[model samples]
Target: MIVVNLDVMMAKRKISLTELADRVGLTPANLSIFKTGKARAVRFSTLERICRELDCQPSDLLEYRPDEVPQNV
Candidate 1:
């Protein structure tokens, strides 16, 4: 499973959702969706904009955690 650490980074940066959204040229609603991990997909351009605004790396925002459920049944 992939988890988004956007809130964490936002906290670290002490930036508000509205502020980040404006900086990244995204709407607050859209950014909120991504922040809450409800987004099914994200474009690389969007990711790049976010990283540029947050001054963070992609790895810092995304984390891969293996699901505990067994794949082979």
Candidate 2:
């Protein structure tokens, strides 16, 4: 499964949701959805802006975790 590591990245950058939203020119509501990992899709331009603001790469914000089948679980 794909996972967003927004929380970790934000923590590492010590940025607040409001500040990040302001920096990215995104509404707080939109940022909140992303921060909470509820977003199903993200725009490339948005991602680039975020990476630029956060000093991170897209790889830093996203991760791929192999699903453990029910049997493994």
Candidate 3:
């Protein structure tokens, strides 16, 4: 599974959602989806823009996490 650490990066950079959206040329609603990990897919161009604005790499924003099984199940 992939995890998005957009909120973490945004906090570290002291950037608001509106500010980042404006800088990245994306709508706040769209960026919110990405920030919240609700996005099903993201374009490379978009990722590049975000990384450029955040001054970070894709690896900083994305993480590979193995899915955890439900112990109760």
Candidate 4:
């Protein structure tokens, strides 16, 4: 399973959801969905924007846990 570590990075960076959303050119609601790991899919452009604003790598935002099961499954 894939886990989104967006909240962790946001905390580490000490940035608010509103601030990050503005910086990444996304609406707070949309970003929130992604941040909460409720997003079914994400675009590379969106990921690039997030990583750029957060000053982190893609690996830092996403993690794989093989033992976890998908909610829909």
Please report the candidate that would top lDDT against the real structure.
4
* Clash tally, candidates in order: 0, 0, 0, 0
Model 2 misplaced regions, further than 4 Å: 68-73
**Ten-residue stretch with the least lDDT total in model 1:** 64-73
lDDT of 1 by residue, 4-68 (tens): 89999999999999999999999999999888877888999999999999999999999887964
Q: Scored by Cα lDDT, where does model 3 land?
A: 0.91
TM-scores of all models?
0.90, 0.85, 0.90, 0.93
- Point to the candidate with the largest TM-score: 4
Better candidate by lDDT, 2 or 3: 3
Better model by lDDT, 1 or 2?
A: 1
Residue 21 local lDDT, model 2: 95
Give the TM-score ranking, best first.
4, 3, 1, 2
C-alpha RMSD between model 3 and the true structure: 4.1
Angstrom error at residue 63, model 4: 0.2
Model 3 misplaced regions, further than 4 Å: 69-73
Name the lDDT value of residue 68 in candidate 1.
46
- How high is the lDDT of residue 19 in model 2? 94
Better candidate by TM-score, 2 or 4: 4
What's the lDDT for residue 34 in model 2? 79
lDDT of 3 by residue, 1-73 (tens): 6788999999999999999999999999999988888788899999999999999999999987788532222
Q: Write the per-residue lDDT of candidate 2 for residues 1-73, one digit (tens) a residue.
A: 5677987998999998899999999998999887766777899999999999999999999887796322221
